[model samples]
Target: MHDDEEMLRRLRVDDLPPSMVDLNRAMRAGRRRERMGAVVAGGLAAVLALGTVVVVAATTGKNTAAPWPGAGPEGSRSPEPAPPLGNCTIDEAPVASQSRMIKIVANRSGQVFVMQDPLKSGNLLRWMDGRQERIDGVPTGDGYGTAAAVNGSGAFVGASGYKPAWVYRDGTFTVLPLPPDVSAMSMVGINERGDLIGTAFYWDGRDDTRAVLWPASQQGTPVLLATPAGWSSEAMDIADDGTVVGYLSHRTDNGPVDITPMAWGLDGSARRLPVPAGWTPARAGKRGPYPIAIAGDWVVGAGARWNLRTGTAEVVEGLMPMKVDKYGRLFGNVPLSVPDNGSTSGRPAVWVNGDVQPLPIYPDRPEGTLFSVSLDGRRITGTSYVTSGAFGTATWTCGR
Candidate 1:
């Protein structure tokens, strides 16, 4: 990714909010010698590799170097997966090698987008190895009805516009009609059953953002999910079982600002997951989860914290629970540490129950990382670069 230098530059500028401006200045005003090897927590992880499958070592006998528990592909010196409970791998590569710059989502299945790497431009979004589709009329940019979620068939792209949001299934954009002054809506995610979970707002959009479950048995107006008070919400990912999770802003009685993170579930009513106890003194914000599997009782998520521990949400610590293969096991905090030297303030480390393991990187720095475990307590994703390199938005999926 080419944005490290740019990330670093922006960190000095737009990275810190006005509230954090004083904190940044104070940290710099002090001497560097006092905090040279400090270890802070609560930062989000960024996936750095490009390819879908990344193997750094074989998973067999030479498990010494591999980060995973099983043997990797033949002839590949893979990082042995860690203990069964903590298996993982890391890989990072430049985005310029291949692939379009903008087509948006990038998993094994490809989509196209505008390329903006240095002198690159004019690239357009289209199907894999195909021509661009024509839209008779539509907007663009922040207000454009961008399709953020794809259905099981990949035929529909859930999109949103400045006005009503729509589901672009079967090549045509069908507006998800809502009755009476429904000014805004957008799709957040889809479940294995092809159900969509998202949000919609009114100019007087009720009290706050709503968590919407779509394909209404009958649609008069978009449904508003019950959420915690003062907890402004937006629906994010949805699980196969229909569990939803996202963020909420914490507030005081006097209506002042409070720490907020990717919040999931409501207070008391919803069975919210727990994080470190030090987050909020008033219990205004619940320890939000990412809804990984949502089994019988558990709702897992890429948990986020305000980091009373680190004093910054952009640089926090989290866990990547390992592959718990058998019973009576506890790998304990196989923590996913993040880069918070405050160099390039991109995203914070927010792995929920993700298994964290050390992987190959530039010599001399054990902290340089690139792999994060998913809350299934198994799957992993992350990024890595030697020399404490930079970041690009597309570089968020470089793990194996």
Candidate 2:
């Protein structure tokens, strides 16, 4: 096995927090899927050149890639017109093509941002009004640098290896302060109010990971979110209204277990998000459904949406939801297939009222994945796999 794959395997089997485990899994899965897609596409092209009719037998059982209770087939049909948001159109976004891997991280207002080669030392690119700029001077070294979340104002936050969490605004990098005695930290999301949220921990021979926040007014000191004893928390995303969403997990003799979705109010009070019926941490192996984004009263993650106000959870099934728009539309990807090994090949799609709408892909690039969606659900950004087996950044715009 390659070094990176081995490292990811160790991380999942060992003591990393649930959120970190999820991240590693996502990275590994993406790499594997892309490679596999390229091979399959190449082989199909060779077969077609010879005009051979290929008949592959189907192995039937419980398809792990089966759509959620009501979802349609992957790429089964064109997306239905989204009311109010209107019909959608797609266009290729400008990106540095030098990187082998590209990831669209966030879309806010009219600005769309991407990370080129995010798993390694990477570059941050931003686009607005037909102009693209590669933001320079982000910290890098032994660890990867990434911009996890961005707000409407274009200010972004993220972390690098062993470095304190930092925010970038107006071409300046502001390293966020850590609490006393904390050894390392990383920021994941920044709100319109400049409140930043992420995970912080120590390397002092203790398994301590906690969700922390740095208010816009006081960038020097971070406030640690409350967690029950024996529990560790990792903040994933913060809504503009100052609500933070993430997960809580505790380490057991075997590993981390009992991951529970959680949300924190603007006043710094933490509340547990409702879990879907029949959901169990063991089903996913030491991890529970965790919220990846919060818009208004909706907390979305793990193919489920939880209403903070109604205290109800709805499972969207088959979707690996990434972001939720204010209209309650969920934007993410669904698995095209799940191999016996459990890895999935995903196609970019959106779920409206429980119906999966496959996004339009470039005529030449058949594979893609969805990432960030604008609050209005009009503009979305992700990666498009080209014929050569490489992928590039892409964006889609929808309107009435």
Q: Which candidate is the best by lDDT?
A: 2
Model 2 local distance difference test score: 0.60
Question: Best TM-score goes to which candidate?
Answer: 2
Give the poorly placed runs of model 1, Cα more than 4 Å off. Answer: 1-103, 106-142, 155-161, 204-207, 216-221, 228-231, 247-250, 257-355, 358-400
Q: Write the per-residue lDDT of candidate 2 for residues 39-125, one digit (tens) a residue.
A: 121111100001111211111221011122112334421223334556677777654443455434655543656454443345677
Q: Backbone clashes per model, in order? A: 55, 0
TM-score of 2: 0.73
Worst 10 residues of 1 by lDDT: 62-71
lDDT of all predictions: 0.33, 0.60
Clashes, model 1: 55
The CA lDDT at 254 in model 2 is 56
**Mind giving the per-residue lDDT tens digits that candidate 1 earns over 1-400?**
2321221221122321111011132332231211111111112232221212111211222111111111133343321222344334333322333222222332212233212222223222333334334333333323444445443444343443444555544555556655355445556665445556666555573544556765334333455554555454556555444545554433445544332223232221222222323322322112222232232222223322221111122112333321121121111122333346623222212232232333333232223222222233332222222233333222222223
The alpha-carbon deviation from the true structure for residue 336 of candidate 1, after best TM-score superposition, in angstroms, is 11
TM-score, each model?
A: 0.47, 0.73
Poorest 10 consecutive residues by lDDT, candidate 2: 41-50
